[model samples]
Target: MFTSQEKKGIFSLSLIFFFQMFGLFLILPVFSLLATEEVEGATPALVGLAMGSYGLTAALLQIPYGAWSDRIGRRPVITFGLLLFAFGSILAAMSSNIYWLILGRLLQGAGSMSSPIFALIADLTRPEVRARANAMMGGAVGLSFGSAMSLAPFLAHYIGLSGLFWVITVMSLCGLLLFWLAVPVPDQDPVKATQPIGVLLKKVLKQPNLTTLNFGAFACSMGLTATFFMLPMTLKANGWERSDWWEIYLSLLVAGGLVMVPSTIFAEVKNKFRQVMVGGILMILLSFALMAWAWSSRDFVWLMVALYLFFVAFNVFEPIFPSLVTRLSDAESKGTASGVYNFSRFAGQFAGGLTAGILYHNDLPFLPLVLGAAALWFLVRALGFPNPVRHASPVEKPE
Candidate 1:
């Protein structure tokens, strides 16, 4: 449990991130189905493109957002991003066709706020304690996933997809209020503030272990995004309603959250990042395999089992990888480093969705698992990469 200040910081960060993620995921339960309806020309690939365009645009802006945060300070850049996201949400709500929804998600990603939020976190936390802060943010995210999955299915059923978009707009507006009113800025030490970006970049680059870590980030996102793209279709095809699908998603989410704490505690004691990554990769592969098996058997139980394991790995990795980034980065440029980490992730989100979309056009439920095999290969590459030298910087507050 956190003290009062830490608690507030964690909640504020979670709320901001929740609003952002809710904007992204509200359509997950039904968007693909909606896209294939008669009015939309029923092109699955285009729906994938529409769903993924936001990720593509967000990846492009991460580095710039991090730099902007460093140059101007975190609050202003974050606020600007949130406003842009709000604009995107409203535009999406009013869109007439799948093409217009694509435009809206793209604009939303263009104003992605993750980099700025992380930069503020880095500024606020001390070095030694940074990992805990990250854990807090990650925990918040897990909670948001559960809440969003549970709420979105019913909400989508009642209000329709466009209504969900409007709801996201309201959430974003509320985030703007919390960001402005609830968060506090840490006083920066000028010496830390003036470090040149290139200098910081070089310092991080010298770390030999970055390849594996970043690859893991990329692969993990790919697996999850692709899985998500398939999930609604999977459940529906298996004869489950949207409400039943939400129950499945929420159950797995809670199970994942329950496992994450113990896994991290064990990881810390053993210093087993390589082992952790390997375990997560293998588990993800198993989820895909199970999915394949379920399809063969046509059983909902196996499908649920696969999802439960998949999310456990996902929850472990989300916090574990970010903590590792904090551990490995140079003291001065944690902001830029985390931005790049998030960059790899959203980039993977784009590629993952497009890959599944194309494959989906060819074959339905089998696609996500086939891609999962490729993700396993990427993880193999990550495992073979070299390790970073320990800088032994004082552990700071979690970002």
Candidate 2:
């Protein structure tokens, strides 16, 4: 069990994470619609670019922001990130064209605070309980995604796309406030980097296990981006109105959350990280297969089932992946290592969005088959993943 301080840190960090992700996901459901219908000078390809532009900027900056947090404290870097996010939200709220919206998204990604935030969570907890702490953060992210999916369309109906962006701005500000008022500072001093950035990058990249995990991140995020890119269109074709997507998302995500709770407990409590990963990847493959069948048959019920299965499987990895990264990485270089992992993740998002957009534009409906192949690759890699120590070692102190 966590002490009061650890509990406070975990709780506060989770809420802050929730706020940030809620803002980001809030736009996902309605983004394509906003681009094609409301914004001026929109093209199918540009819409995809606008949707994914943030991932490019975020991927580019994640390493520097993470390394910077290593020298300075997490607080200052996180605060700056939130402010940049808010400024971008404001710009997006004011934009009447796709180009400005894409620029706003780019600026928002430039903030790139995820690595530092996770590093802070690590600083606050011991290795024994770190997975649990990360699980909390993952739970927060899942909840945020569900809430945004359920709310965005309804909110969009009432407030328009600009208003949705404004809501994001407010949520981000709330996160900044929560950080200052609620989050407990860690006791350890910041870890200063002794090696240069290039050396650190090489070290992190050379770890075979981290390499596999990085590949997994790329594949998983690519699958997610492509899935969402196609999901909205699928629902529309099956008779669900744009605003009513919340009903499906809310129900399916809730079911996923239910399965996720038990699966998470089994993985961490039973020390079955490798099994969880393999099983999760398998689940991803099965989900894609179901989606392919649904598409071929135009079966609405089958589509819902596939999506529900997807949510269950995807949520399982949310906490486990980061927990593994932190555990496998050197204590002194936590921020840097996290940055590398997240860079792969966001880079996958960019590629997935662009590829999906191009395919959609060209009338080539190949996302499910492509994602299924990616999942197979991920599964092959997971088969060899080293089973990390589950509470077998003491938390290493920074050198």
Candidate 3:
């Protein structure tokens, strides 16, 4: 359904996403342990800061990056972002202290490539095929997540966290090269804004449907980040070793992917967007509840079930959310809308990490965190998310 150039663009961008995400997620499983063991004067709060610092910078910079891409070009912005990312990776790798590590993570987040990359995909693909293109990209991210989970322990064991950072740096540089060589330049003219940034932001925010999806993105991310912040420690406390983590994550990821295929097809091809999304949200809520129970009871089997369900729900929503944003937005403001959407995502990441850190530092129960996630999901469902498939073709054109 895609032209050769479109195919190339999709594949190139997918690789860019894969490498970047892979590098970012590679440290998740071991970050808390590393902070306490290696870094000077590390505490739980500091560990959380290091873990989430990237999201803060990324959230703050995403809109600017997207706006700049509109002013200059996607390729230039993407190239610069990749370079920044690599620099951050190097900084992180060289860090001998937690403070420096936090700074490096902030720099990593400052790159904010997601907005421009999605905008570029919108530029390259037809609206009809945009969902498919996004699905491909999301699948790449899922694969990267799986690969990172499977590889992180081994890599950390063999070479240490510093070595992993170096590997991330190399991966980002590889992304830059792939983007330059593989992705074609867009033929479109520069975007001439019909309104100021404030007005544009207001307009996007005022779209009830878009706002619903944005909230969904935020809530989902918040749940994910918060869970991961505690999951590793909980697992360790329950007698699961770091070496065995890969097996659990790999198995869950594979199972999630297996279920994701049919769910995605049902949502996209069968035009059951709302049903699928609602189901996914419910699943997320249930997962959180189960997670809380498992954590409290130290039931390894139940914890695994909760994680598997979380992954399944996460994959279901990941691709659909971005495509929905693109579909709902006018072409003129796609970059802007995408920036806002991504901003929400990163903001959730920041909030989740910070909350997790504070709770862990205070030695509080995990029940609040899980309950908060459930509440957020309930709010998303109450917002009445519209079905993109119902309006897909007609809304593809910009207003």
Candidate 4:
């Protein structure tokens, strides 16, 4: 663990990451209801489009955003992106129509500097301690996610949906200002291996193992996006209030955190990377099947247990995959690989939402349909992955 004073800056960096994500996630549950007023003939598809458009924009921009961060410096590019994000938020907040909302979300997502943010972490931390820094970032993500889901609905009810967007805008601007004023420039520029983009792309994506990693990120995002669409609704049906669903998130994430520590240790120290990933994927698959079952019948306990299991799987795999990505590629292209991983995942988010909206539009149930398909698809992908752990692979390790 970093000393208290030393860790403060990173913690603040983590906080900046958290609020940016919070701004991203805050409208998820509230958007469908809000959309009825904003868009003419608003249907599930358009609603999904409005909701997910941000991720699509984020996906498209991440690679270039990453490269831009590399060229200039991390903070300047990130600040510009945040300003762009805030601009989008203000537009969304002031808009009365869905067209504006969609535009706002697209720009908002495009303005997100996910690659830049992670790049800053890469620039600041040593490789030996990088996993811990990455884990801290993951924790920020989880906390923001839980907090956003819990708070967004209540805030929407009281202040309206636009209010939530404005709040995020304010938060984003504040975060940007803090970064500009307080975060110091690193003592030295990040020394990086130079490679042509075409060559780097060929080397990383063409490698079978990293390709598997890309698919893994895809499956994980697809399954997560699809399944989470139903969980709150399921809880609502079981006499739980919509606002109270975060209790499950809070509880399960606690368990997930405890389990994650052991999983990371066992994977790294004991060098059981492949086995651990297999277990995480299997756990996710089981949770999907279980969620389907719970939804088929009104079984609250089963739903609760399945949610707990699902979050556990998410927490374990989220950090591991990125760390493993670091192992699978040259340092020159590690940033690029991370960008690809995020792009694939966000692409899944876009597809997952679009598909879920379509399935949900009909009388036949859809979250389960999409998630079940995603689960099976991922199981196949998991089977094809080569373990990236240094000790386990006979393949001449990641150079």
Residue 268 in model 3: shift from native, Å? 1.6
Ranked by lDDT from best down, the candidates are 2, 3, 1, 4
Across 31-127, the per-residue lDDT of candidate 3 in tens digits comes to 8887778888788888888888888999888877776676667788888898999999999999989999999999899986999999899888877
Better model by TM-score: candidate 1 vs candidate 2:
2
Q: What TM-score do all the candidates reach, one by one?
A: 0.88, 0.95, 0.93, 0.87
Give the alpha-carbon lDDT of every model.
0.72, 0.82, 0.80, 0.71
Q: CA shift at 255, candidate 3, in angstroms?
A: 2.1
Single out the weakest 10-residue window by summed lDDT for candidate 4.
390-399
Winning candidate number (lDDT): 2
Quick one: best TM-score, which candidate? 2
For candidate 4, give the lDDT of residue 279.
87
Worst 10 residues of 1 by lDDT: 390-399
Of 1 and 4, which scores higher on TM-score?
1
Q: For each candidate, how many residue pairs have backbone atoms clashing (under 3 Å)?
A: 16, 0, 0, 1
lDDT of 2 by residue, 196-228 (tens): 777777878888787778888888888777767
Question: How would you encode candidate 1's per-residue C-alpha lDDT over 201-269 as one tens digit per residue?
Answer: 566566556546666777777767777877788777777877777777778777887878777766655
The candidates, ranked best first by TM-score, are 2, 3, 1, 4
Q: Per-residue CA lDDT of candidate 4, range 1-399, in tens?
A: 564433655677888888788887677656666666545666767777776777788888776666555555677778889999999999889877777888888888878777777766655655445556767778888788778877876787788877888998988998897777765555556545366656656676787767776777777776666555555555555687656656766676588788777787787666666778788878887887786687677677986787678878877877677667666655466666667777777777777666666665354445765666765666676675664444432122542
